[model samples]
Target: MEKEIKKVNDEISVAAFDPEENSFKSFAEKGFKSVINLQTDEEEQNVSPEKEEALAKDNDLEYRHIGVSEDKLSEALVDNFRQELENLPKPIVVHCKSGKRSGALVMMHIGCDKDMSGEEVIKQAEDMGFECDVPELEQFLKKYVNEH
Candidate 1:
């Protein structure tokens, strides 16, 4: 929890740093059961996936890395991410370079899960400190909500 942790709800949080080994233990001590990473291996500032997975195991936290690039976001990807979010044990911590990608996915999941309007979802995310500034992500979310 060295970085700022933005709680989206009681069950979920988003942050920028991939917790280090000690921080993983802190996360478990703080009641986080899972860590979901949205950045790809190639992303700048990302820790190696091997290290992240191992640390989660050492700390008794489930770890999942599902990379989502802005240019490549699709309904199928978001649907898959939503399913994973539903299945993963919580309270969960999701992170990317700056939390934007994680926020986008979480916002989309909330919108789809609660049958909320896209505007409502965006406002909720903004209130939680996750700015949805990526236009591709915004467009995808709007389309996803309309179709689903």
Candidate 2:
């Protein structure tokens, strides 16, 4: 819980650093009703999704794992993420290994939600220190923003 939980719009928030298995209680204490984990299962140090879900349930928080690896990011994944975000309880925390993936999706989701242009979304993300540096990722983000 050392990292700050950054506010992204009204209902969505993100942690500045990755959350360990034991961070669920702290998240619950911080009033996050849902936890969105963006880390892939194959990634090092990630506990099983079921374990994380159980931990979240133990803390009385909703949990969903929408892991999108850096190389595997796609429009469908972003769409799925948006659907999950819309359906989940409010005041959710989105987290990935370094917060980049979480930030990337947040920006895309907000871009559409706020009707921001692609450039505006990217600039907002960069201003928040969460630039989508990867070219492919950036393309998908812009595409989502532009089309959605």
Candidate 3:
């Protein structure tokens, strides 16, 4: 899979494998305050939400589990997730199976919340491999801006 882990930036990072699952124990040790997991347990090979929750709790980080799917990335869920996200502390690690869908959700959140253009959002999402091939996701995003 070419190691689906990278610094999307400095504060926000993405990964298919959790740092708690491997090296980089510093992320956990340094008291990162929150973790928003977009990954569903069944889809990821070795990731367990229970284990993640344990690690986060052990590190005193607040944890939220929002299990989004290719089939159900709807507007309502996005909005609700965004609301919850706004309440979380910084240095939040939002992750999914490959972090691609989480990146897509982040793009959608930016578009829906900050009035970013659909073209701008989709372009960023495409850079992360979160394309419009999925009908549900496309329809939801289209409703966000009335364009494909």
Candidate 4:
């Protein structure tokens, strides 16, 4: 997991992939308060979201799921994610398949929230090693950050 705290409001950690069973306990032990999963159910990985949620709860961590896929990455989805972020406990760990999606979303949120430009968002994403290789996300980020 990659840890970074923003002055804006949240302490977010982006995971390289879906959290494993042991990872949940580790997160709890490490003082992470919440889990925000950005994967859709259709993209099956190591563990199911339901099981992941159970594991998080068992570890006494808040768990929230927002299914973001190629077709699902939109301003509305990001808005919903922001709303969830507002209500979720701080020091949140967000994850997707390769961490790219999670990073992109978080950076986009920062960009829009702070009124940063699309270029700035893209540059920061590159600096943070986030890849918006997926055409859909690339296009959406370019459009959304500039528009909002």
Candidate 5:
């Protein structure tokens, strides 16, 4: 049996694991309201969005598929995900293959969500296995607090 790492809070409920293709069944049972997927087609690791939607519909959970990369999270993409974060209902689950992308996105959001510094957010990402391959993330962090 595969185990999902659970991060519970009033604002979010994240799970890190490869959601079974049938995991939708479990999601329904668990009463999750939303899902944020971080996998990307650029890496050839695309999951079926149609299937995911079907499962979400069956389970009554709102699902959003956003592709987040570990090595390089583009400014535009980060902004897009940031917007999604703002739109998502609380207690959402964000996930990727090994939780790395999920962690990075979560860190990015934290930098904005909690007013954390880039180094602080990077440390958070490092704690999960995401390496910062570019300097843009630091700049993004600086701007996050001032703007969104």
Candidate 6:
């Protein structure tokens, strides 16, 4: 399937596959400075992290692999993801197998950083063409808001 890039906001976008060479060039030309991959290396049909990273670097885009698996999703991971999102240069592209994890992580970052409610975050994600409905992820987000 051809990967689609859905812009989440002015500074961030989400997609599935790692951009190929031409795609990377287009992103660079369009001013995207970095990419964050949320899929684990072992995921079926995933692009090799090493190859994708090399291509991104060759095209002058900073590449970060965060590798979040379904079973390992947690508040700490969300925190680190947010830190990376804040630390990385924008505009950034975050991607997973189907953009689900990427979108969820972005939602968590927005919920925590902007103090948005879970419903608000879900609505925002849906508006961006990403459905955020992972129960574990949602629970973690709720607990995080309650704690902090």
lDDT on C-alpha atoms for all candidate structures: 0.81, 0.87, 0.65, 0.81, 0.67, 0.78
Candidate rank order under TM-score: 2, 1, 4, 6, 3, 5
Predicted candidate 4 versus true structure: per-residue lDDT over 46-84, tens digit per residue: 888999999999999999999998886778998888787
Which candidate has the top score in lDDT?
2
TM for every model, in the order presented, reads 0.91, 0.93, 0.75, 0.89, 0.74, 0.86
Candidate 2 contains a number of clashing pairs equal to: 0
Pull out the clashing pairs in model 6: none
Q: lDDT tens string, model 5, 53-97?
A: 677777778888886654556668878877777787666777777
TM-score between candidate 5 and the true structure: 0.74
| Model 6: per-residue Cα lDDT over 6-44, one tens digit each | 887787888755555566677677788998888787876
Query: Where does the lowest 10-residue lDDT sum fall in candidate 5?
Result: 137-146
Better of 1 and 4 by TM-score: 1
Candidate 1 — which pairs collide? Answer: none
At residue 30, give the lDDT of candidate 1. Answer: 85
**Each model's backbone clash number:** 0, 0, 0, 0, 0, 0
lDDT of 5 at 76: 80
Comparison by TM-score, 5 against 6, better one: 6
Relative to the unseen true structure, what is the C-alpha lDDT of residue 25 in candidate 6, on a scale of 0 to 100?
70
TM-score-best of 4 and 5:
4
lDDT comparison, 1 vs 6, better candidate: 1
Give per-model CA RMSD: 1.7, 1.4, 3.6, 2.9, 3.5, 2.2
Per-residue lDDT tens digits of candidate 2, residues 47-130? 677888999999999999988887888889999999989999999999888778899899999999999988899999999878
Quote the RMSD, in angstroms, for model 3.
3.6
Q: Which residues of candidate 2, in runs, are more than 4 Å off? A: none
If both were scored by TM-score, which would come out higher, candidate 3 or candidate 4? 4
Query: Which of 1 and 5 is the better model by TM-score?
Result: 1
Poorly placed runs, candidate 4 (over 4 Å): 1-10
